[model samples]
Target: MVDLRLERVCEEASKLFISKGYARTQINYIANAAGISVGSIYTLFTSKKAIFDFVLKCIIDGNYMGNNMALPIKESDFASLDGEILNVCKELSENFEKHILDGDDSYDFKQMISDVFDIISRYGVAFLIFQSNGSDSGVLYAYYVQFRKLFCENVEKYVYNFMEKGEIRRCEFPEHHARLILETLSWWGMHVKYDAFETNTGISQDVSKNVAMDALLHAYTI
Candidate 1:
């Protein structure tokens, strides 16, 4: 059906954009990848920019194919999409602070760990696309760098707070251990799905998160 091909166009275009970057991806290349004519692309998209905008909006909405709305997908404000990602980055840090209630004896580290993995799993596809397409000095890459630093800072805060309170097991080079825990969560939560070298890529997100959280808990607890 025309609608299915339309979806294919968007899906293939997204992959090309992820692999080749937006400016470098050609109309002919996208058409060929989608098994469609350049004219067919033009029938719906007024310009290559339109196609890119649609794909970007879909990615921001969730992942590959969006809600599959009717044809000639409207353009999205890049500022809005940019802000959405930036806000997510900010919220991750803020949420960590919210969980770190001073002297709150009932705070649950396992629940916090679960929530972070859920966020990563929910946005994994979009995150992966931006990471691959983002140039080293581009805004997208900068967003990723900001997120990494914030995540590390929060993890450090948690480790130090809990260690001082005699909660988590104290260890030599605690900062390094915090980094290790972050990497472990990152791998299983997000990167595992896309890791070409990972043999267990087929595991469900539930299984991945449980295993990752268990590893961190067992490794860090007394």
Candidate 2:
């Protein structure tokens, strides 16, 4: 089991990294936020980079329990890293599956869209970190790209399933529709809340999700 103090360190470090950017965030800041000593932090993580990597992995896999953060994986452990990436993909696929529509009606489509938005909202901070170009973490970015592809593929499958069910109109470009849906959700559920610029429209999550659902349903419904 992971130590509670270690978990607190990772959580505080992640928040600081997100707020201050990776380069500007310091180990001391994390120590202060986590109420731990700098030496204690080093006992858990070899360096700042290691802590960042651990936080990134935890965020991507939604492992808030800090199970992954407890034991730091070695940098040379490519196989272990691949396994972690696969776990992230599996977690994302399960979330997408939960939102797949099962009925042939606008209400079903709307609920699916809302659920998708909620999923994105739950992972909003992680997505923001993934999109940050200021960070030099190429490995994290690559894993994020893989996760995005997996998510879009599952969304495409849902689109095809809905089309076959006669819930949505047949389209020649299901991939395009899936991309549009993902982009819409990402912007409304994530960017609007976390982007550096003034992108907030003062719209509630329900209003934004409802508007997006209405637009999508109108465009694709029979």
In terms of lDDT, the best-performing candidate is 1
Compose the digit string of candidate 2's lDDT tens values, residues 31-138: 999998987777777678777666656655565453443344334423355467557667767756655444434435556667778878766766666666344656
Write the residue-wise lDDT of candidate 1 on 115-201 in tens digits: 768777766656666767666225766887788777788778778877887878888998998788777887887777664366344
Predicted model with the maximum TM-score: 1
Candidate 2: clashing pairs of residues: none
lDDT of each: 0.71, 0.70
**Model 1: ten consecutive residues of lowest lDDT:** 62-71
Tell me the TM-score of model 1.
0.74
